[model samples]
Target: MAHQLDKSVPIPLYYQLKELILNDIKDGTLQVGDAIPVEKELSAIYGISRTTVRQAVAELVQEGWLYRVKSKGTFVKAPKIEQSFIQALGSFNDQIRDLGMTPRTEVLELEVIDVPGFVSDKLNIPLGSKVIYLHRRRFADNEPIVMVKTYLPYNKCKFVIERDFVKESLYPVLGESLETQIRKIRRYIEAVESEKYDFDYLNMEKGKAVQRFISIGFNYRDEPIEYSIARYRGDKNSFEIIITAT
Candidate 1:
């Protein structure tokens, strides 16, 4: 195959080929879900070995730029949504919309339940205290991205049980209904194996990992207002933390 790929340059052939496909996708030459050229065709186009083409394609697949279907060729994939926590404290709806994607939320469960010991401690409430437990699955562009379980002191937050989470976000509701503003949020995150909720709500397969976030929101009075457990599909989401120098 005659090619214009610079063989005299020090850059590897496979990486160059990978960049070529990435540029094509960036410039709208390849739309999402469009199948990329086969290894043989790509090899011919680049005058590279089949192995080089395979390497480039495999890297793209691993990096979430492409996906492979058994008995079918590789296709372009939607990019992961970046969830920036530190840079902005926007609601999921606002954040997803800023990224040019539609945001949707489904309330899976909403009821008052006895607070478990762990949740009680987190909320600094009594162990036998009742809480408004709200479970939700959030989506971006109709794709399931996260499942969250939120616990709020029932005595104060019972109003939330009646609000329509599908058409609303909890944070805004809290600000409107509560007497004080949510002044701070403490969050802990870890990578953990997916559970039943992940498999059921997130469409994750067995053995897949999820990013678990435990967040405690505090009011202006320094009292805990909400404790939430959110699990995000690692492949569909990425967290970005911005660091600024003082």
Candidate 2:
């Protein structure tokens, strides 16, 4: 592990150590599952106290960047997956796997409800038409990362609700069941402060910053098939768009 620590810097020693470890992992100097030196060894090498080393290691473990096994020692964790906004065709499951974290979903609620005017407009369906409402919470390594609300026409995809959504991605199921192709998607994003309901499900503090995304997915026939609204934790997420000029 390589890190440049300035003793004169105002930052605390533990935080400095934490950043060094994190940077080493991010830069590929430390590979996943690579064992780190024990606390006493690290302290001796850095000329710091064991308490400082322990604090840095503890924080890293909490953030999923490191794992500690009893009597085994600390090991670097796999990096989080990166999702490119440049490609509209992307899967959240694949993104999570790239990040070296397990992606788990909890289907909080699912039911058929009358389409509201906003949803009807987005889905291009008649108002009051039956729609399948899917409410779910997505987790990354057991940390709640997003809350999603998705709507689909009930008549077209009634069987979709019967499948296990917890382990499935909605896009693939829609394709298989409806014989539909997700030709394109439109997305919008904005920053918002967390609300009471967000706090309840996401276990986030009210007034915390969050990123809200609205997506409309269309089929090959240029017909809208899915409308979804999702909120992600600002602290844990970043969206990148790649632009190429011709």
Candidate 3:
């Protein structure tokens, strides 16, 4: 659909044009993989310069709404690759399994290590205290989706650090081996750009966005027992929160 910009308005031409294109995608008038009008055509129809069209399209591409193919035109991106992330804070393995997808784990590092200061503070242990650290790569349908680093006080989960995590998930292992239950957890989530490990494991572009989740978990006694940092592929995951007003 052609959108006319009122030159009389104060809005920047490129930005105004961008909203028009964005609306089309949001409304599904531009379906996934659908090619948008070429720059020349858009410029002529919108009464804007080709330069303005290029700028608008560049922003859309960077924002994950559109993608370009060499020697071809730009097309709407596929629907965001996302999964169910609810406020209940279920394990990723459980969530993925319930979705009928294969959830695989690659045990990158599973052993006790001297705790970093940040981890020590979160788990309420002394700095340099030994902690069971588990570095794992989590996948769905064989596609890497998250990198997880979990720190547990050595006294709390030392028995778990030596198990074969490649065949089992950490939460389940904790329950079976230590009879530990997760009573509560606090999570801080934020958007971030891909780090080096994300690039290597998730096959994401270095500048692409990721969702970082920092969690501190407590046991039945309400004592903090675990601290973990998990980074999920932003393009592949989203979260939902259900609220009830008191």
lDDT of each: 0.88, 0.84, 0.84
RMSD of 3: 5.1
The alpha-carbon lDDT assigned to residue 155 of candidate 3 equals 82
Residue 194 displacement (Å), model 2: 0.9
Tell me the deviation in Å of residue 132 in model 2.
Answer: 0.6
Of the two candidates 1 and 2, the one with more favorable TM-score, higher being better, is 1
TM-score against truth, every candidate: 0.91, 0.70, 0.72
How much is 43 displaced in model 1, in angstroms? 1.7
Off by over 4 Å in 3: 1-66, 75-78, 177-179
User: Which candidate gets the maximum lDDT versus the true structure?
Assistant: 1
Q: How far does residue 2 in candidate 2 sit from its true spot (Å)?
A: 7.6
| Residue-pair clashes per candidate | 0, 2, 1
Per-residue lDDT tens digits of candidate 1, residues 1-246? 222577899999998888888988888888999998899988888778999999989999999999999989899998888889634657989999989999999998999999988999998899888999999999999999998899999887878888999999888989985553567888998999988978888999989889999888888788999999899998888889978899
Pairs in steric clash, model 2? 80-99, 81-99
> Model 1: how far is 102 from its true place, Å?
1.6
On TM-score, the candidate that comes out on top is 1
If ranked by lDDT, best first, what sequence of candidates would result?
1, 3, 2
